[model samples]
Target: MTKSPYFPQPAVASNVAITTEAIDITTLFANAQHATAGGIVLFSGTVRNHHAGMAVAYLEYEAFEPLALKQMQLIVNEACSKWSLSHAHCTHRIGKLAIGDSAIVVITAHAHRSQAYEANQYIMDRVKAEVPIWKNEFFTDGSSAWGNNTPPINSK
Candidate 1:
């Protein structure tokens, strides 16, 4: 297996590609404060082999690094302000990935299920709609296409 890009620590609660070869979901939950929270929502987006019934073999992703990171930070900042969310973090995978690899993970903590669920949805939705990240899909037929768009900034 390949080592993770995140080192000593996973990112703080924010929207971005996050990993903790040392810090993972369990670690996040452990670090999360146990308040009067009644619910927690976690969302994970993974690589699948089929899209629109076409067999996908793999995928390669690239990003306008500086801008993409900025947008991710923005997403988190927005979320922190929009709800009673206690803690939220978003992590996405970069570089080439095979089928079944995890592409993203979003976690939210709230005192109520509604807030957690809604915030989780908003985080993922906004991440896809605003982040300057692009994916090049590799098909079984030896073909590729830019996902969303090239430069990724177009989607933003």
Candidate 2:
């Protein structure tokens, strides 16, 4: 059987992938679980039907897969080190995606729930701000444009 593009071997804890297929959130959760893990957090970023009051038709994502995966791995490694995580896995979907589809998933396991939650959020933020993935939004008005990464208004 062919291995998932995300995790080629079971020995490694950090897993990252840039795929065209739908993300398997269950597999990511399982991969993030470890013997010493007391808590697990999973985050899924889904495509929505509306953006800035405009009706979104869909989204198209493109990335330099090699560079994207490398940057993702770096984010996971940083989160693991900062939180003393037991395991971490993340996957980002590329290509065309419909509304309500999961575009990305991040799973983190740690000895504490707080650590798991914080690390999961941190990893996602870094992925959004630092990863090379680019998203183009198609609006119902027959217009499309590339999306930019803007920090949340409350971001510190």
TM-score of every candidate: 0.77, 0.86
Give the per-residue lDDT digits (tens) of candidate 1, residues 1-156. Answer: 764432212224554553323225566566544364567787878788976556899987777777877887787767766874667777766788888777777787777789779988998999888887777899999888888544434232
- Which lDDT tens digits does candidate 2 get at residues 1-156? 985544312224588888999898877777766776778899999999987777999999999888889999988988877777778888999999999999999988877799889989999999999999999999999998788664224322
| Model 2 TM | 0.86
> What's the CA RMSD for each of the models?
9.8, 7.0
Model 2 clashes, total count: 0
Query: Candidate 1 — which residues are off by over 4 angstroms?
Result: 1-15, 18-23, 149-156
RMSD of 1: 9.8
lDDT for model 2 comes to 0.84
Q: Candidate 2 — which residues are off by over 4 angstroms? A: 1-12, 149-156
